[model samples]
Target: MSQDRAAGGRMGDSSLLRRLNHAAALSAFLEADSLTLRELRAVVGVSRPTAEDLLSELLAEGRVEETAPPRQPSEARSAGRPARYFRFRAESGYVSGLDIGAHKAMAVVTDLRGRTLATHRVELDPDLPAPERLQAAVSAARSTWTQAHLRAADITGIACGVTGALRAAEGVHDVREGPFGSSLAPYSLPGFTEIDVAAELSTRLGQPVAVANDVKLAALAEHWKGAAQDHRDIVYMFAGHRAGAGVLIDGQVHQGRHGAAGEIGVFPMLGWETAVARLHARGAVLAAEQGIEPGREGELVITSAARQDPESLAALIAFTEALARGAAVLALAVDPEVIVLGGGMSRGGAIIAEPFRRELAKLTLVPLEVITSAMGADSVALGAARMALDTVITDLLTVPGS
Candidate 1:
């Protein structure tokens, strides 16, 4: 038994070494564009014999492609000869990213560098049971992945941003009605519980998976590539059918103690309950004053109010003032360098942005730079894809199997 176990250990190490060699060779070939065995060794940090052994394995895997860049002989300053370089055939692999929302889901496929090669979006029933909804979402992703002419094996990692809070300990999230509702039991949603989205998709395609809160993912997207580009500390306020926030401090997301830190929609008196109600009230008043039909529940009648109906305007102003108060509290707590207003309704642009700034100014002595989200309605989804890509890149570069 001991001899057999020892043999198994040796086999495992051999397989791992092969994988590591492939990864290192692939990393150098793709990143450096071309690399010799020595450079591959440096990247892999392995002995020459080990590297050679692994290179043979990679060749068998068809992961490394030999390149014959015209080599020029050195003038022999030290009597040295030129060496051949190799490149990884990364074109052989691909990756996918998915962004799941309450009512919609978006997916994107990209090559190793994160350049988007294809994208897709589909509407979904949020009311569906968690598992079913997740299945629907996964189906959508798979459809899009197929459209992109890529399979699951092409996927290296998946980063997903969910609408609910990702519980700190559970690799899952807790879905609540709002900050005030009964804490729902743990959910088995795709990005939340089963984490099965990745595993299931991996079974279909073969890859690792990662997940994050959609809002936090959006904040990361903005921090890395969008509007909040200038400031390290920022409060990203995303207001839509639902309102929430994402906090970035020193270029990192602060997920709060309960994984609810940026759960601004639940921020005490200013939580989702109060803020959403205020907005709904504004919508109701606008409906009454302008004789316009009431917008659906939780949706503000922005068009009616913006039309300059006196009563509706007053109600809208009041709602804006309440939002300003929420922003003020955020200012006091995080002291974010910039407060970014984003989400669906935020597309009303100055309607919410300018007034929000003025109202915030009235409450606090410290003036804050307030701006609309540059990413707009697609911000969350785009951020989710970016988050997925970030995970794939990180894992490919850092972790062994990923």
Candidate 2:
């Protein structure tokens, strides 16, 4: 009996080692883009035979593919035949990211490497019912995947960004009704407090869906491919139709125990609650003068401010001051390397930057570098895609047969 138990233990140990080697080899292929057999062996710290076996397994699973090596320069060519190379099959699977907001539902489809393949946007009424709003977001995602000429079965993961705080319980997130929830009240039906956004989206999409606050996702997008890529610690501020913030500490999003780590705008004393009201009031007048819909007021205000329209510039400054107050509180608490301004208003970042910095400086002990988002309106959706890609990769690395 003791011998039998020892044999079982040995088998378990060997299985664990094999799994580890498989994961390591796949990780190397992901990071290096492509690798030769010799390079894979060195990177994964495995024997030649083990490396070949790993490659064969991944190739059979469609997770890897052979690629032609780059042509060698005439002088650099040393051998009669070139070594073969293998690469992660980024095209093997795809994932989607979605941003569901008061005014628009946007979706982005990306490959395993997080390359955007297609995108779709659907305009929405702020007063639309919650169920219809969610349906619209799903439709946008489906449209984007179709635009990429891919089937729903090809999507390995999906993620969504919404307006309110998400409380996680047993791997599921429930949208908590709070200040942000009140802001979303116009779009929500009765019993909004009991809604499970992640579960809803997952069921609709026929796959597991990850969900988080939209502002937090925007911060992730900025860090992944936008302004704060060079900085590990960042504070991301959303300064368009509404005010919100996202914090990254040590290169990870700092979601508090309840996932409200950067919800400074919730505090009434911070004045973020009324910040966009200033822009809206000014934008209303500007829109009327230009004979446009009130929805375009925000853009008109920014454009007018750019031309140095005194009234419009004043409104922009007032909005900036109110926004900076909330940002200063976050900055004092987190001391991030940079504060990234994003959202719809960031399109006029140049006009908003100076006044925002001036106000922030007055409230903080040290000056902080402030930059605008490079991702613009697509940041939240892009970040959502990153979240979905992470899920897919995690599953790929852990499952025994995957």
Candidate 3:
């Protein structure tokens, strides 16, 4: 991940050297309006020979590929030299991104450039036990394989985004706590075991699995592909049956020390807990009218609200306003450049953004930009697949015989 970089700053002596050494390799592959070795060398104040070496290294790593445009040889060069361009490999090996939500799991197969090729979704019994639920996610991935028209070998890696705090491998409570304290203590997920899920999925996929909070993954997707692209710091908030937020600082997702940094739902608001309960209770009542059991685990009380049934829409607006109140608190503290609204209920970003922006303006003096996520419900899944791709690419770089 990139660190906190000062934009538009004058290049320092050593910094210029480093940038020149790396720019040809990485920037060349990325899409740009126009680029050339001469231009890159000029930016770094390096000699032509040094620039040639940098380009050579990039070509050796297969990071950049040269292409010749389809044109008459006479048109190809105005002064004498032929024009050759470079592009990042769009058809590189595939990555599988997965999102394990409370009631559903979705997986998307994408290329190195993050273009989706195929997708798969599955409805799971939210009331079922944890291991069984994980197995359902595995099944979803396997089904996606066929849908994508790719063999298992074509899948380079898998990334998983879940809804809980994941402890480091050493922290599992496999033993009793000592006089000081042991790493192994039971971590709870209402219907799943975190360790078990990670272990089972890793084993089933035959590759390492990265499990992170779902909202964090959503924030990552926004940072990678949504309105947050211009801002290095951002906060992604979702208002639904459950409310949550994700933080991104310096282009990296901030999970905090314990992975609970963005669980904004637990943060106290003005009678927020009560209001949320009432909202869910209202949803349950409505679901009952449709013959859905009030206590069913997968029952979407909030989904029903966001569908714009007159009374439900009214309730949802109140919730969005209340959510804005919570966001105001975050804005005052972090002061990020933008806040992205996401999740199933956030479909009407225009409606929600207008009211939330109005409410936020009343609370803070700082200029805050609010926008909706382009990835929407697919954010976590895309992020997960990216995680998987990272594992495979990283191994290919480091392992002796990958």
* Angstrom error at residue 56, model 1: 9.9
User: Tens digits of per-residue lDDT for model 3 on 1-402?
Assistant: 111122124344455544534653454445453346775456445567766776666667676566655455665557767556555555557888888776677888887677788888887655767776677778788788788788877777777777654423343211222224522211223455434566677898887566766677778888777767788888788665466677788987775555555555554554455555666667777877787754431135445544656766566567677777777777777888898887666665566677778888888878788887777667888877766665665554442311
Q: Which scores greater on TM-score, model 1 or model 2?
A: 2
lDDT of 2 by residue, 1-402 (tens): 332234345666666667777888888999986899999988887777878899999999898999988777899977677889898999999999999887889999999998999999998877777888889999999999899999999999898888774534335475456554454211233334567777788999998898877888899999999989999999998887877889999877788776767877767787665667777888999888878865777789889988989988988888888889989999999899999999888778668888998999999999899998898688999989987888889887884632
Arranged by TM-score, best first? 2, 3, 1
The global C-alpha lDDT for each of the candidates, from Candidate 1 onward, is 0.64, 0.83, 0.65
Clashes of each: 4, 0, 6
Write down the TM-score for model 3. 0.72
Worst 10 residues of 3 by lDDT: 1-10
Could you tell me the lDDT of residue 389 within candidate 2? Answer: 87
TM-score of each: 0.69, 0.90, 0.72
Candidate 1 per-residue C-alpha lDDT over 283-316 given as tens digits, one digit per residue, 9 for 90 to 100: 7664576576543422445665667767555555
Relative to the true structure, candidate 2 reaches a TM of 0.90
In model 1, the clashing pairs are 152-205, 153-205, 265-271, 265-272
Model 2 score (lDDT): 0.83
